[model samples]
Target: MVSRKTLAGAVAVVGLLVSAQGANALSIKEALAATYQNNPTLNASRAQLRATDEGVPQALAGWRPTITASGRYGYSWENQRGTYFEHANYAASISVTQPLFRGFRTVNSTRQAESIVRAQREDLRVAEQNALFQAATSYMDVIRDTALVSLRRSDLKFQEEQVRASKDRFNVGEGTRTDVSQAESGRARAQSALNTSLANLNTSRAIFRQVIGIDPKNLSARTNVTSLLPKTVSSAISIGQEEHPSIQSSLFMVDAAQFAVKTAQGVLLPSADLLGEASLTDSNATGNLGPESRSATIYGRVTIPIYQSGSEYSAVRQAKEDLGRTEILVDVSRDSIRAQAISSWGQLNASIASITAAEAQVAAARLALEGVIEEQRVGQRTTLDVLDTQSDLVDARVTLVTAQRDRVVAAYQVLSSIGRLDYDNLGLSGARYDPTEHYRLVRDKWIGLRTPDGR
Candidate 1:
């Protein structure tokens, strides 16, 4: 069974490609920038971070005063001492209830919300890295497949030339009927290979559009991420454990869980609030002969929780358990990041070695193909010998192309594993999405119906 990472690394029958660089060439960095700005998944993650930012303000609301205004107008009929009277009454009131103390629930909840928002930022980082990685892969795939198609088409043309030459030689009694048959057979196989390569190229192009959200045009395969990576595998693993978004997010979750436990316990403690109210009422109690009344008062009250239900205790205990779970998950995330970093490091090393060997192999295969063709021309080698050598050359060149693409992809994998594959590291100068900008705008907002973007 192929390893998951290696499955897509090598094309079954690939070919060599010469990269072109033009002023308008779409570099991998530009592709990544496009993906960062246009990928739906990355954009959704950013939106989710903004939603999490709202949690901070929601938590802060617990510390703010609750103000309300109410008014009522109605008619009532009453009979007393054999006399009946109907009166219209109206009342309007405004009240404010400010929490003088909430047993530290507001403080703990606010801290928890802040922690959660931090975790969400890390989550957005993860999503960004994932989107960029996939975009890079799609870009490389299209290049590799396109090269294969070009090589196969050239091969088909060579086979066609060989078929005509063999038939002419057989007609002149310089070659046997077997030579013509073999040439024709090779031509047929080349046609089939060309067809397959064309299909693969189309598939790659479709995937490229799906991931990058743009049709590829003069895309340059220039994703070199090794410079952003650490020097050694051990160092990479260490850095990944420390800086990987998953690990950081998990750590924040642990902190948030701890604060959540505290918030839960706060519910079991005493609470205090200050209430102020002003009201004006007009009543006709004496058959439309009554004066309007207005009153205003301010009062403070505190209540000690004796016992309402056992649910609060249950909630506190559950929160403590959740905190423990989050703490353990921090270690889990660290281990996972370490493993990924080490694996990516090994892949990068392998890709570098493969590129060197593949280049040498392609050169040797091309020389061998030339020698075989000369031998066949002098009647020292069979026509099949020349065809087989050509096939070998094609395979060697294909391997080289695949190796080059793999090298770029492996470097990205290594950079991403250590959490360094980001817009800043990639040198993308496009408009940056700042999650903290939204967070800062909303954190201390006391009143707002619209979002930071006026949505």
Candidate 2:
């Protein structure tokens, strides 16, 4: 039979293994920071925001003067009255046009661009939150699966010893062959469970790498975000409606669409501009006639739209329709964010409750298993009873691990739902991403081929 001291030694070894793993653990904050800095999807969103920033300068360009320069040179030969003649002419001119009025198109277009940029900034925030949440989920999954694998392996070891004990008893006629066969079956099942747990651990690790841009290394147990969550679901939904990135982005979109309607309306109005031109021309004649001339002129011009095949009117109607759509989308975004907040809040609460229940279950199962083992030693319980109790203990440990993981992941989900899963709120230490800096750099910039950082 397996000695009690041997079983205790095995348990101590497993505890030491767990302790060693904890000693080199990575914190959730460090994982989130790595994800924020390296996640491909989040970085792509940042790049997209930078692209949107150019719209402001494009709209502002409408207010600036346009200058054009042209030069032409030509040689010609002609026969007149049976006499051959050759002439060469060269001309160069520069023209400038500055818009004095464009029916407020520039103003409305600039406003629209500004609103769109702000919307894109919110979009980036959404991406950041999503990436961080995914990273946190994957991190917790790894931890959970790793613990389950360890538990399964330990269970398998105990079952292997049980099988040996049963065989030794049967050889001495103290136990039946049925007891040996049952122990062997239990050991095989434990091995299968361990294999499954290992496979799950590998899958979780792959997800961790994909989300965080690095393989998980000694990940520590993550602290629950209960301290960061709102006290009530109603409060969470309220915060979500007010601060969620999706809702904020949609609100900005509505503003942009409204300005778009104004810009489209401006297209129907007259445009006025100041125009100036300067030119130089040189001409040579074969009959000893050559001349050079220079001229400069400045004038104000107005262009009144008379007919455009109803295109301008159609554009105005389209803009109005778009405005209506955007206004409706704002409400849609609000509803979706609110729903997410409520669902996540419920999940967080459920997981917390589950953790508490699982803890109690683990304690009860541990005591039951110890009682069964002692009863078996006293010949009051069969070997199968002891094996069954050990299996129950392993199952209880697995449930506890899963509940812990769920609690951590659900907490992050709640934060994400309310739009608080960000570096600032989490107090993560790193270079904070600021979209406004790029916008300010390019908003009023008249001319630049390079970005703010010279990229």
Candidate 3:
């Protein structure tokens, strides 16, 4: 049987091969995974999640036994009627205390901390999704730019062919000076378009490289345009609402606030605990004596609060208010997520339609340009008309390429909104790097608590 580490390494190699073909080739999924693992913003969110984990221990401290130790030394001398005496004393003791009652403060506090941890975990998830979504968008842009460059180069070839034909016709005295001028102008414009497209392609590739942690300059690949859009808007909305990280994170916030109220209630309740201590002491002086003996005392304490000048009451009320406010926030988040789902769904559909329309436009423009060129050869079309048709063809091609790229990006955005833009969904081929992993490792040691999920 293959070991897990070996399998992971193999998968990583395969992933590299998948994105390293042709010129400036990279898959959107691979780029997303790289961004998810390395983006600074996502890493920061992971840190915040670990910080929230400390709340657990802070709350637990209220319930655990408290121990304290102290030591003291004293020296004294007296002289009277030609007699002098000196004495010294030393004492050390340890004390232990356990809370017997506190208005349910410990219980409420622990629960509140748990809720906050949950909220922060969801927040981490949301951040990861956003990072991956950004990477996907940038990846699609690079692909589109690369394709448009190729298209522009092909158009330039056609322009060169037209120029050659115009020259041959002029040599036979069958074409006018204006016809040659028109062909030459068309060729020049096509070259300019190709140069611009190449520049845009390079910029887009650089952005993808920064996002995916891999250079995408020598790989050229095309995507299937028809598969860019989802089949149903209703399904997209439903899925997005269920998986969207922001909404889930907000839901956890409500849980945390409610727990805060519970913690406040704990402040007024009774609690139970056991405590023990040890001590040693020595004294060289005693009352009216020349010598003294050492002694030690150890004790435990139980504290019960009856009044606090209304501070406890205010704390409880404030906690309740916070809980109520968070509940409202949850409601607001739900509405906002629903609205976002609907909006993203519509935009995805519109982008898909635009892509189709743009493709049709490119095809029509190409045909029109060809027809005008033929008419120019026959002295039936003006030089300006031929030039205009060539420009239209180039613009249409570029527009179609951009529209297709946008459709792909929009599809990924819809998935991200639903909270599904995770490593598994992206189909990354290596060990998933969770930025929270290190934080989780140290959370227990730093906070003195068990994992909330018991993992």
Best by TM-score: 2
Q: Tens digits of per-residue lDDT for model 2 on 1-455? A: 55666555434422321233565678888899999999999999999999999999999999999999999999888898999888898999999999999999999999999999999999999999999999999988887787777678778888888998888878888889889889999999999998998999899999999999988998776464678999899999999998999999999999999999999999889999999999999989886767899999999999999989999999999999999999999989998998899888888788779878877887787678778877876788898898888877777677677777787788899999999999899988779888888888888898779898888
lDDT of each: 0.85, 0.86, 0.67
- lDDT over C-alpha atoms for residue 148 of model 1: 82
Instruction: Name the Cα RMSD for model 2.
Output: 2.5
Ranking by lDDT: 2, 1, 3
The residue-level lDDT of candidate 3 at 374 comes to: 69
TM-score of 2: 0.93
* Candidate 2 lDDT trough over 10 residues, lowest sum: 11-20
Please give, for residues 1-455, the per-residue lDDT of candidate 1 as tens digits: 11222212232334334455567988888899899889988888998999899999999999899999999999888898999878789999999999988989999999999999999999999999999999988988888888888778777777787888788888888899999899999999999998998999899999888888999888777555667878899899888888889999999999999999999999989999999999999878654676799999999999999887899999999999999999999988888888898888888788789888987887787677767776777789888997898788778767787887888888898888988888988898679988899999999999879987888
Candidate 2 pairs with clashing backbones: none
| Residue 265 displacement (Å), model 3 | 3.2
Clashes of each: 0, 0, 30
Whole-model lDDT, model 2 = 0.86
